[model samples]
Target: MVTRRRLPRAFFERPTLQVARQVLGQRLVRLEPEGGRLAGLIVEAEAYVGSEDLGCHARAGRTARNASMWGPPGHAYVYFTYGMHWMLNLVTEREGFPAAVLVRALLPTEGVEVMRRRRRGRPERELTDGPAKICQALAIDRELDGHDLCNPDSRLFLEAGPGVPEQAVTTGPRVGLNSVAEPWKSIPWRFQVRPEYIPSLAEEEQTP
Candidate 1:
């Protein structure tokens, strides 16, 4: 059986890079207004550490747009970008610290039809494949910014899933940072595991 256990606040109160790697194989869950549960297996993540990391938003220091990053761990530090797309980042490490793991992609496991409709019928594999697409597919936006993910009563939260072994993971530099200088640009902060590494839930266990 696929158990749905909420990850504790302590899970995110660790180093940013460690949280990024460990988040893979966990499930992002959104309890919809229509009383449906939408969830997916997180497959990719990228860590952006504190202010000294030039490639990170915190590099500019904490501004109104990024204030949530300085809040308690296990909260969502969602933001808008490209004047259109919304990106979701889960705050990590100590309170007042600006560090988070950007959720990059997911393997949709529940409420697939709802996600497809929200994505306007994109190909199955394309849904929730990117950070923006994940926000789009799950209806995550700025309204969810600063939301406490560790709260079971909250509409959005994360659940433990199958553990992805270290050997199955691949790491690389964060994507879309052409303007960033070297070192930060080249650092292996992104981590991912192939979808096959995630075991499929039985049909009965997949009902949302």
Candidate 2:
């Protein structure tokens, strides 16, 4: 349903904060193993900058767990969090920069039944509302870590959707950053589209 192609590498290689906001209306597409495509309009994302930024995982420096964040831009940095759910981050800020944008929510756009199955019986709004929840509903996991989102063959890819204007986005402190303090905690790095802009998963009936 997107008129434009997947966002190019140069698009994601820019400043982390810009990428976070720009990704708001993009469509994240997953090529399922069963020969189907499932996608969602990215509704929310958070920017995590460099080591100096306490809210970033790189603040503690690179370990085996966060090495992907240091790799090329437009790569997936999937990781497990809290021993339960996996969170998906799109590595940004170019190679060696170690910055990323955590995709926090999605508005279902395609393959609604596939997402419903993956997410069990959760309500449509609750299915992909949080970082971990989006990961679960999209079948994203550690296996996709470091996957190049710029490559079409990759199971995960991003497509251009309607542009969300600055006025249509709401900015606030990044979520789940309670442990971090001061300016880092207060930076308005979190970006989300207006609630009314989120479309339902129900597709229009087709005429065969």
Full-model lDDT for every candidate: 0.91, 0.86
- What is the per-residue lDDT of model 1 for residues 80-101, given as tens digits with 9 covering 90 to 100? 9999999999999999889999
lDDT of candidate 1 at residue 146, scale 0 to 100: 98
lDDT tens string, model 2, 1-64? 3453888899889999999999988889998898998888888999999899999999999999
Residue pairs that clash (backbone atoms under 3 angstroms), model 2 = none
- Per-residue lDDT value at 188 in model 2: 94
Q: TM-scores of all models?
A: 0.95, 0.93
Listed per model in order, the count of residue pairs whose N, CA or C atoms clash below 3 Å is 0, 0
Worst 10 residues of 1 by lDDT: 198-207
Q: What would you estimate as the lDDT of candidate 2?
A: 0.86
* Reference-based TM-score, model 2: 0.93
What TM-score does candidate 1 reach?
0.95
Worst 10 residues of 2 by lDDT: 199-208
